[model samples]
Target chain A: MTKPADTGMTEASAPVILGQNSGPLSRAISRLRGHSFAVANLLMAPTMLWLLLFLALPLGVILVYSFGSRGTYGDVIYGFAFDNYLRAFSPIWLPVILRSFLFAGIATALTLAMGYPLAYFIAIYGGRRKSIYLILVMVPFWTSYLIRTYSWIVILRSQGVVNTILQWANIIDNPLDLLNTPFSVILGLTYGFLPFMTLPLYASLEKLDKSLIEAAWDLGASRIWALLTVTIPLSIPGIIAGTLLVFIPAVGDFVTPDLLGGPDTLMIGNVIQQQFLSARDWAYGSALSFSLMAILLIGIFLYVRKVGTENLA
Target chain B: MNDGTPSTIEQCEDCAIRLEGVTKRFGDFTAVEKMDLGIRRGEFFSLLGPSGCGKTTTLRMIAGFEEPSEGAILLDGVDVARLPPYRRNVNTVFQNYALFPHLNVEKNVAFGLKRKKLPKDEIATRVADALRMVELGDRATYKPDQLSGGMQQRVALARALVNLPSVLLLDEPLGALDLKLRRQMQLELKHIHKNVGITFIYVTHDQEEALTMSDRIAVMNMGTVEQVGSPEELYESPGSRFVASFIGTSNFIDGVVQWTATEGSIVLGDGERVIIELPEDGSRPVTVELSVRPEKIRLRESGEEVQPGQCMLRGTVRDVVYLGMTTQYSLHIPSLDRVFSVLEQNVEIASDQTLWVSGEEAILTWHPSHNRMLPSSGA
Candidate 1:
């Protein structure tokens, strides 16, 4: 879009200066030369329009709704009130929030514990097969995340593949209860987010200099010591990135918990979903979402400040 | 432990590191082949070669980073082939410095010492002393990336030296530096080796770096050691054609031995005879190649008085390269159809008079003893 304007400016300026004309056309050409701001704004128009319509406008509507009230007959009434936010902190909803934090935290930890070694293996020892290993890590994404989560249910449910195998092997007289629990929720969250954690970890680990590990080992560090002192410290950026990638979405995840969790394993996402769709309380749902966003932003802000922005991957 | 004092003559006789027929193979390709070498106590020994010539593989074997596929490596008279790098009594200064980006200079230097679980006071003192040795004492709190390239290299040196291992293996530690910084670090490294009195096994592809810093050098080629000698010995009396060509620039005159005598001579392809001093055994090979250093050849005007026992070749000056300290004249002999380089020192000659015009007849002469014979197997 800017190409013709640039050529026009060059071609027009030459004739205007050579002819020494100060007419309206020449003045307009000079003004066009000084209006690069307008050109830049034009270039940014598509992204600005996208953010305004899809991101900022939706966020503004949510913010406004969080302060409004819920009407009878399941409709939103336009009125300023802090009742939704106040109710979010009440004893009735505190357990749900706490449960979501616990599930997200455990899932993030599990993902990190599993992803770090896989990333290390791919980065350090994969050799010429590194791309193959990376593709294998990403192969789960070829199927829908929802289908992958459902497959775990097929494996973990009583009388499913795992329980049937265990019974046929005669290792258990009774099938253990593995599905519809907090364990299943955390497992589903971890399985869904494992690739998210592994990719950033791989990126950071791949960027780490192999010589540093050798230098550490040369300086009298054992293999484990070198991994702890040199490898782990150098991959801190990957760790932070992987944590944020897994933890943020895991906290706000509704589908995994809704599909896998029992009645006793309710999370804040389930509460928000109920408020918005079943209870028809959009204000309360917005309040819950805003609170989650605020808490997550604050936590991320503190973490980045501690680790320093320059260390971010 | 010895307070940085020079070792006694008795201690100097001990071999600190020994490679007993060590060979390293990566699958089908051999990186190092049956290399037997001994680095003495308090000696700065260099493994010099072109890239992929097994110089680095030899160093890695000694440092225990690579296990020799055949034979063994010994450190201070003890076989350490089975030991890991941490268990070996040696440290390596990597080419890129390999300073830990997460650690400060002090912590980097103190890394090895802390691994030994030394007392806090001793670790501090030694770390400080090492930083002072590298003249980077003030940059202790700074990370590796915060320092300049040269400073980071010094921190790597200090980090390895703080351990005071029985041997210090340096794999082209100054290879990353610019020429000026490299020269400075070469002197500093030599000085440190003298002070610490540790056996230093250095590896480099740069022949000049090997010549400048090593007390003795092993010139390697194609997974084998071509020749091992002092700098002067390697330059003056290279044992193989590979060593002669790799160490320094040499003018190779290919010819067949005509007759063996006190003053032996070889007949060139054009039937011109050049005088050379044969080996004492007097078993002259059917064909031989002679290496003459460019600096050793003198360019004189025609019909000049030739000293006795001096061989002379007459040719026309094809090109003149006026270097700062010396002017190189490339003489093209019509009979040989080759250009012989003769480097003449511009001691009294002014810069304007140094340019020897092309197509000028010149006589190239060198002492008979300076014509070093190379091995029959040509490189």
Candidate 2:
């Protein structure tokens, strides 16, 4: 074998400098300690640049546009005006905003109802196959969300697989009106966000000290009572996190409504899309978007104030 | 085979809980073999053993967490093998002190009482009383995370004790405390047991803790109980080698019986003999192992007179360990090829002229009654 590097080196043979304050090595150590602030700034530069370029610039443009007037040709005319915000708060948009909230709230409730038990099973009773079950939960995300929404269309259309099966079974004389309905939209939203709710619930339930449940049982609480008193209360953080994650996005979701909702089920997202793409009123669209953000922020603020932000995992 | 104790069924009449041939097995491995035990009313009983010795398993069976694979567990003279944990009148103080993090100290203590749907005033008064018992009366509003580990342990105790169950099972409740706190908690727990007058079944791996707190102890090994007795009885006469070595420092000498001499003296092989008093009709000519406690062996200086009824052996001192309370001497006897330990109290200074040092010949002497003989097989 070849001789290894530093074979001749020993601790005593290493160089030692006298007058520690004046040595280059001592200067280097002092500089390293004092340069930590500069190093932290450098480490954060990329993220700051990305946020400024993508998020801040777009939001600033929207804020500026919201104050301008809509031009004759549907282009944004640069002029100070409050007409767009005034129209945003008018009764014309009330139904759409309320509808969005209704759909989001129902979908969130449905997702939580279905997700908690599934997460509890995987975390508490899955045993050695926990990783495999978690992988199965995430497997549906590999497909594009658009393809998944389109697949629902294929399943729910009047002449699609579901109606065909029902007709074959003679369950009904005519196909049910399943497509382009608010029910279908809610179903789509629940399916899309189910994993988001389950993962956090699983994380919180998995880290729970199992002995608390045992102690509850030992304290004369039955199985159902123990679950309600100990397991559910301890998992409030996961419930809050999952609700925020599903509700915030489902409020602004346009795809599921665009494909699966009817005219009667128009949410604020569809209204904003119409303003931008069909009506070509960029200022009005920006105003609606800012209004939605403000409402969501206020709702989130009240929620966090009520539940306490420290509980968020 | 009778140790002069009453049968388990007869004992169960007045006992708080009794286990009759309880056996627990998990698939291919047995966690606890056939176990028969009874805990008397208002008694502090301890199941003492090392890890995986089935002490905790036996406690769990009594608490209704595990059902015995073979036999029944009786609580208050009624079989509770089919009862769920919630239906059983027992509470467990978990080793981790699993106090609810979300609930404040008062609410945690009131959990079981509230489940019983007691009146609101009754619940409040009981919760206050329980908190005061654990010396946590002022910290009622503090969450479990806000308190120290010792305080959390006290809260766990209060929560379990507030229900006033028929039996209280503590699974090494003080195993997580530091040395000083653990000692303090041991005394406090014993005091609480006396004040509550509840049957306490404690499980621990610390032999000293068991000795300090238990009124009766069952020493278990290899998923089976080796011996059961009071602390003094078990310490004075351990039934098996495992119990002797596990409970305290014991020196064992292996030899075959050569002959039975009159007046309860037995001659051993290689012309060695010991004066152990035995009954007149006792059997002989079988191999035997002798166990002696280190404190029982006296280190005699040169020219020390040997009294009658005292058996003596000469050995060379190999090493010395100076503990604070006592000094242990390791003596090597060349003829028997064994090292025997002798413990002496450190009341006298080591510089005294009578003290023996390493490599010095010393005579080890003890009374014949101090020698305990067990069969070689140890059953």
Candidate 3:
């Protein structure tokens, strides 16, 4: 141990090597250290630049625009204003936010209910055919998101195949209004994001040791009870991942509400779009976008804290 | 080892599990083929083999994880082939101790009892008993991840044993443990087997572990049972070269019969005549292998008198390895190319030189009965 006075003297003085305070050797060492730091910064430059340009800059822009004034021609004015933010707390936006949440929650629930068994089948029973089935799950996306969403329109419309079949079967006297409803919005969202939910769930379920289930069986758990007690609980992380993937996207989706949901089904994303495009109010739209971003960031922070960073990755 | 009590006799006499022609196939691949075994109640039987040798497959089939494609599995005389694993009367202690990560030690142990729908107090009592048996009663609230590997393994054992199943299937349960912990757990497992008196169907590739704990061992290879016998039977009198080499250590010498009759003898490839016993109606000029344990080979001086019924060979000591307890000497025998022999550390050789290689002639002999003759096809 060094004496306290020696420690103080050492702390006050510059670090020296070979008992030399400053010389060519120290300059060479400093150059080497500078070169290493430069190389490290160069290696990490692309990722840091990407975060700044694509993530941080856009988020800063949105925050700044949230507090700025809306010009007459839908352009942001560089002046302080809190009116748009105050309007966000009005009953109009509150109901819209609650409605969007309701739609996202239902879609998440349905997606989980439907995706779980499919994921379980692929993980446990598909065996050597797992990758093939995974490719099959992704095959729907090969055609285009818009076309897939339109295909739902073709099926769920009043005179579409589903309604025609139901009418011909005499299950209903008249064609059902399957489209232009909250039900249609939920159905479309779940259909579009089902694979996102199923894939993560499959990854978690596949990692489950079959012997653990066997051990449960050896412990004399019934088939249903084993699923409830062991299999489902062990798959909690996957379920959370799937729920987040579906719910986060569904809450902010404007296409599903535009195509499948009618006038009363306008969500917050549609409201933001209307504020900037039709209403020509950039300030309100930017504030609304920033609020959504803030809520999502808090949600993701809680999620990472609950699960782990590696699991989220 | 009998207790001389009628109750003990009755308990040991019962057959806890019996498999009849049980065969499991994963699509085109045959995992376990035509396995027939009867595990006695309260006996520790091990299915020992290399990987993909159907040992784990057999244990899984017995545990009802894999249904045999063509056979019957009887547990306590009840057919469990068509039954799912949950309905079976057996528990499995899996490799890596697949304890429920979400549940604490007590809850994991209590899981089985709750399924049986026993009263809450009875479940608690059995859980406590099992935890005490594994010497982990105080760690009731700890989750599996919170405990050390050995403690987690004990919790797995306790979880399985709490149900009091007729048989416990341990699928390489100690495979993941370190060497010292494995040895300690091996003794604990044996002691638990004695205390519980439940049939144990252990699966492992470690011959030393099988020899130490198993009452009987079924050695499997390529989805077939090579041999099933007690440790001493399998080690001492192996019926085939695979068993002889697999169980312990043996040096094989390829030989053919030059002259054979009631008093059997054969000339080795290098013109050394070794004495051997023949079957009741053995054939002539048969290609066979002569097996001798390293311990049976003896070293003697060149001019030593050759005793009756002893085979001797002249070989130069090429290298010696001092193995603390025993020194292994690699000898270059002209009759057999090269051979290795182990001698006890206490024994002193005739020569003092290391590499000048004096005393090139070493006489090796053993009883003719110890010289097993095996068919040369699988060589």
Candidate 4:
């Protein structure tokens, strides 16, 4: 299919006429094409600069400050110490960190159990209205996350929607305490992160070859057994992806816990926010956030190892 | 079909699979209409038709993928039409060889056995034996993505065969392979069927493959079965014009029922007449339409001598196609207003290497034994 004149002018045979070529700019462009690394670096320059300015610089400052101690006036102490690190890991803060992990884990599990069937139904059985179903799944995300969390408050308050309906129906003698509980916080997290779980799972399930399921059924597998053996195993990539998307953000989610949680439902994110904004203990705040990041990194590495790195990508 | 076929397809108890007035309709569009068929036990029965002719739909109904809109799909005397595919004692080899990508070859083959909760050692030995049957023993740990298309197809076969179902349904299973591989797999499949001895219900649009492998083939058209018989019976005595054109090349000529199969005269549209005859098969053709297979007709020099009672026509050679094994000549007969093709073997190699040239006048002749009447040709 090559043009006749271009056959002899292949890359290996083409003369690199730099001096007589057009102008210096064109010559430089041709030279740049020869070195793909230059083109790649040029393409990546904006993203690299953005990350360096916004992400790396802040993280570097935090790393340096995390080793420093708070002054008497809670300001200007520039000496390295293990005191902040030890305090970040102390018994006083341990409960909040552990609760953060536990809440995130439970919320992630709940979202997975809820999202998988929705994704399956939309992807497989949605048929001609699949797009509408998918849009409905994502309807909650169209509103602001803050507004959505606030709407949960309106619903879960003592005399709000559920309590009003139940009281009118006389299901219970008194209004139930639905707000300011771990359950409320967990429910909020699950609702907010549902689309995050479902979209990836839908992508995986939608691409699944339906004939594989038919083949399984033909091979004597009952419907439930076929789903267990065939459908779930093939959609592992989506499961892993959705879990990562929901679990990582849910762990440090301060808004849900702060809005819907009681005093007993405090998380590490709230503790970090208090140290930075309320107490103005920046050094300890940096220490706590750094510890959180390190723990998350370790947990991700362990999780990826158990699931096999191949499944994640 | 408008022309009446036998209404009573005798209910035989020994049939491995039977469709009784099974009609499948998607909305108003009927995919399969009142398909009554009987497949004998341990026979390689093929549902052959062009795409959208309901061959695959009929196979799916038998496999219980879709329940019949009307009537029963009986598997060995028991109506299993309403049962789900998993409950039916039959398996299907999907056209695309839908092997589970997550499972290796051994695990894929053992999947059906595992679903049955077979013991550990039995599952292991059976999986190995199935792999060996498909000649994929060395590739047990290889994922489906790792194997070539042909090998993956073999794995699919082993996966279905390991279940030992009473009937195996193949929906054009070799359709995805290259021609050479498809030919090889076709022979291997026939060999496997011989050893397994289970009734095989194969659905394919390829008439040649059906003729090669099937013990009996049911030719379907539109939404109904046109005819069903052995390969020889179909090629020799097609029941209708559709089967005649679909199965092989046929030059259909409208004729009058002047006499029985051994003697007849056809009155063409332009006041011309043609003579034909063929050996009778114990009954008179119920219709007057006649046809002859193209290969049964031979082309000779314009003035070649011919035996008595041999039908002859003169036509100009319009196109010559040297198809490696046989040279096909399309002759334009102005009197008949049709282009009749004549196939001749390419066995003679002359020093000049000459062949049939366009614009050459030639005489085509064939014994009337090749002339046959269509049973339902009146329609």
Candidate 5:
């Protein structure tokens, strides 16, 4: 008892080991301690620089081009005007823009319908094979996107696997017109984006406390009602994340439409692609791109307001 | 004929819940086996056991979360063996508090009532009353993640209690709280049980909690019921060595029984004789295992004159632990080849010393009535 106070006094008066605090390097270290976030800012410099170079600079160039007009020799005149914006909103391009949104929304809904049950099965009932099932969801990512989209063509073409099987089974008298349609485009888009929807859904659903479902059942809720009220509501964060990841990219997808869609199935992405590549009107393309960004921004804002971003990751 | 215990297979309509030969098995592992028990209406009954001892499994069967692999579970004389939990007239308070994270306190409490399609204003009033009962009336608009753990537990209780089910199954409800909060909630739960007058079947692994709150406790061990009695009855007259040791600390001494009709003497392993009272049943046996609680043994200075008819053993203090209200001494008995414990109440510590110091010689004595003869093995 008499020795404890002496030990405590020695510990309390311990010397600071700042490694000779008179040097310029020591002083620089001391100054850095006053602003702790400076270290974090230093660590973030590379990623910030990358974003500026790749994302911000390109978006800024498009913003500037949206104010320009096409010259007679297919060169940008660089004149300040809203002519391209006005053309982007005209009835001539309205149908394509609406079709883009409609296809993206349907593909997202289809992927969700397919992915939720698969995610639920893996999270709740996969048992010891859970990691293996999650890896299976990611196997398609190992192949090139063009190869996977081309594989869908073989399955959906008039004389491919599905049509041959149907003809042999007497399900159809002749080979059906199954390819180069809006249905084929939407199918390909849904197939490609399914993992984006499932992985986030799996993350949230797997982290859900299973006892909440039991509590609902104990409080007199049927299985269906419990799914609607408890399971689905608790997984809204994952739903919001997956919807944004799938829908935002699906709205701008050109590969699926270019390969599978008919002439009648022209979406906004095809129009934007034609303006830049074939029509040589980069100004109109830039305007249409900015307008699309504005539409998605307002749409996401309204969605977040309605659904509440408080639980979002 | 004299004891009020209903014989096995006897149906009692007064029992709020009864299990008859209920056995549950997962693959080859039997979780609960051939269990027959009855709980009275409005009684606070506890199933106390260690984790793998099947207390939670029994609660789940009662809550209709799991159907027993065999036999019947009768609630209010109706066998609900095959019904789902949603169709049963019971609710469970889970250990993790299982509150809906997305719903506020009021909406959570109103969930079951709304399922019944009650009027909106009626649900509002009942929800308010339930929240007030748990003392979370002002937190009605707060989501579960915002509330503290104890507050979330109260909301779960309210969510279950607002339904007013005939039976409330609590699966280790206070297992997550700190000690002081658990004690406070234990008392609050007792009062709530009294006011609500609903039969509560609580499951816990804490022995003292069961003794404090339960009217009757069914002590489970390894998927079987070891003993079932009132807490006092269980502590005073445990029927088996498992119950005597599991419910609290007990010192066991085994010896050949030498007895007359009224009293008996045990010639211990080393031929040291000790006196004991015969059980009132008076069925004399050849050998016996006797359990004596720590507090039942009184520690005194060496060479003190122990009263006649009291069992005494000479020992030396090996270890001492000073709890606030009591001091526990580990007494090493030489002739018995064992270490015995004696818990002495410290009402007043003598000025010269604090209870018994280590390495001190002492004699442990207790009345013969304190010697509890365990039933013969395999009986």
Candidate 6:
């Protein structure tokens, strides 16, 4: 970039004048620079159009519908009403919201508790086997998520491998009640989101300066103290990233609950899915979809505000 | 218990660290060969070597970051060979200044004190003292990323110093800084050494840095100590060709010993005889390489040259580099392809291209003392 401009100025082929002419070549190059800026702006036009049309338009539609009335046959009616939001906060809906939060929170916490050690082990001690370990973490992700979740049914069912093993081991007299419960749902969600929790945390932990830990050790901190004060604190961004990844997706997840959870432990996602397909209430479904999206958006907003946007390039 | 511990600490102050035939090996590669080194109380010692020469491994062994494959390390008269790094009373200022990016400067400096569970006020006072020591008191509120390289290095130093460890291990602490800042910090480090009076084990590949600041330097090569001496001693009388070459520029002349006199001097195969003191119970025809420092060799009027003494090599100036204070001459001698010579700027080398080059060849003389016998090349 610097060389071409110097060449242009150096290869002077103009009539000698009191002042340099700033000739047609220079003008053309300057015009080319202007055209390049315009081209760059033109390059962004489609993406701008995409955000405005698809993203902003859909969000606008949802926002409008959130405030509007519901028609008799479950269609959005274009009249202002706060009933859906009010209904979202009603005593009847509180249990569902609380249940979603509890499930997601438990899943997030469990994912972190399990994933962090795995990530830390991979980063610190996996050595030449690091890629193989990482591949193992990603293997479950390769199988279709639904298929993996369904495979849990095979393992958790009455005659499944887990029950058979337990029976063989004499730990249980009968096949245990493992599937179709909140525990199963939580287990399924944790299994599904393990990779999501591990990869980013692994990335952050891998990039962590080993010298910081050494510095901690130098400061007379025990290994556990060093990890708690230095390693864990430094890895918070990864924790936040992993938590949001697990929690947001698990909150809106219907498949895990549908396959593994009992009717008594049904989450908001299962209810929303039932509202759309079984109940055939499109208005309430849209409202429920909007609600899930709102929660996810808020989670993402907090995540970005706290860790992502503050440091991410 | 406190009285006994204090007495123990007092009695153990003579040798800050001692390594007994320590050897570190990673797989088949020997990072540190069987080595013995002792660091005295409150001394600034540098482990000087090129990259992969195991200077860092030695320092890490001392810091308890690495365990020796053989032998033990005694810290303050106590066997700390198997102790974890956290259990050792040693701190390391890592090369990149490895400050916790999430912590502000004050918090970074205070990190060690926090780990020790010091009183809050004590931690604050010590952190302030550390920051002030590094002249970074005003930047306490800034995070590591907010500071420049020099400031970051100071923060690392402060973090290490605040702990008041029995020893401070600086692993190329200024290696990451720019040249000007590096020089500035080198002096700053020397001042810190003077102020703190703690045993410092600094590791660096830079010869000049090691020469400038260390109380004693251990010159290492190929996972072995080449020589150990003060800067002047190492530069003036290197024990091997490696040390001679590594410490400063030198001209090596390889020749066959033709004859020996009662004194150590000998005659070469080409009838270019020179004299040097001989070792007791000398053997004959012992082939040896002669090491000559560049600055010690001078050019003079050819015919008026002093009688050839211990060693002399006829060489011509091939090129000249005119540095502001001193001039460097690249001389080409048939013995060795090239030899470098540093001379004062006023020592004019006239451009009469065919000028005879010889001087009081006595300064070029080598003694049995000066001649460092090295393994003969497999010619």
Relative to the unseen true structure, what is the C-alpha lDDT of residue B56 in candidate 3, on a scale of 0 to 100? 89
Q: After superposition, how far is residue B62 of candidate 1 from its true place, in Å?
A: 1.6
DockQ of 4: 0.42
Against the reference, the lDDT scores of all candidates come to: 0.86, 0.86, 0.81, 0.86, 0.88, 0.78
**Best of the candidates, lDDT:** 5
What's the residue-level lDDT of B213 in candidate 6? Answer: 92
lDDT of 3 at B202: 96
lDDT of 4 by residue, B218-274 (tens): 999988999888999888888888999999888877644565445666544332345
Candidate 6 CAPRI grade? acceptable
Q: lDDT tens digits, residues A121-238, model 2?
A: 9999999999999999998899999999999999999999999999999998899999899999999999999999999999999999988888888888999999998998889888
For all predicted structures, in order, the TM-scores are 0.90, 0.90, 0.83, 0.90, 0.91, 0.85
Per-residue lDDT tens digits for candidate 3, residues B1-379, read 1111112112234588888788889989998887777778888999988899999888888887778899998888889998888888788898988888888899989988898899999999999999999999999998788899999999989998888889998989998887667888999999999999889999999999999999988888888777777899888766667777888788777765656446566655443567767654455545667677777777666567667677656677766666544566667777777665645343553456342244466656557777766555434
Candidate 1 backbone collisions, by pair: none
DockQ, per model, reads 0.39, 0.39, 0.39, 0.42, 0.45, 0.45
In candidate 5 chain A, where is summed lDDT lowest over 10 consecutive residues?
Answer: A1-10
Q: Chain B TM-score for each model?
A: 0.93, 0.93, 0.88, 0.92, 0.95, 0.86
Local accuracy of candidate 1 as per-residue lDDT tens digits, B68-152? 8998777888999879999987999999998888788899999999999999999999999999999998999997889999999
Error of 2 at B94 (Å): 1.3
Stretches of candidate 2 exceeding 4 Å from the true structure: A1-45, A71-75, A309-313, B1-10, B261-272, B279-281, B302-308, B348-354
Instruction: Say what the interface RMSD of candidate 1 is.
Output: 7.3
Which of the CAPRI classes, incorrect, acceptable, medium or high, describes model 1?
Answer: acceptable
lDDT computed for candidate 4? 0.86
lDDT of 2 by residue, B186-257 (tens): 889999999999999999999999999999998988788878889998899887788888998898876655
Residue-wise lDDT of candidate 5 within A178-199, one digit each (tens)? 6789898899889999999999
TM-score of chain B of 3: 0.88
Q: Write the per-residue lDDT of candidate 6 for residues B1-379, one digit (tens) a residue.
A: 1111112112334788887788999999999987777778898989999999999999888888888999888888888988999888899999888888877899889988887888999999999999999999999999889999999999999898999989999999888876666777989999998999989999999998999899888888878777777898888877667877888777666556555466544454343344545644364446666666766655543344455444554556666665534556666554445554635344454555332333222122233445544444343
Clashing pairs in 6: B264-B276, B264-B277, B264-B278, B265-B275, B265-B276, B275-B310
DockQ of model 6 vs. true complex:
0.45
**Candidate 4: lDDT of B55?**
91
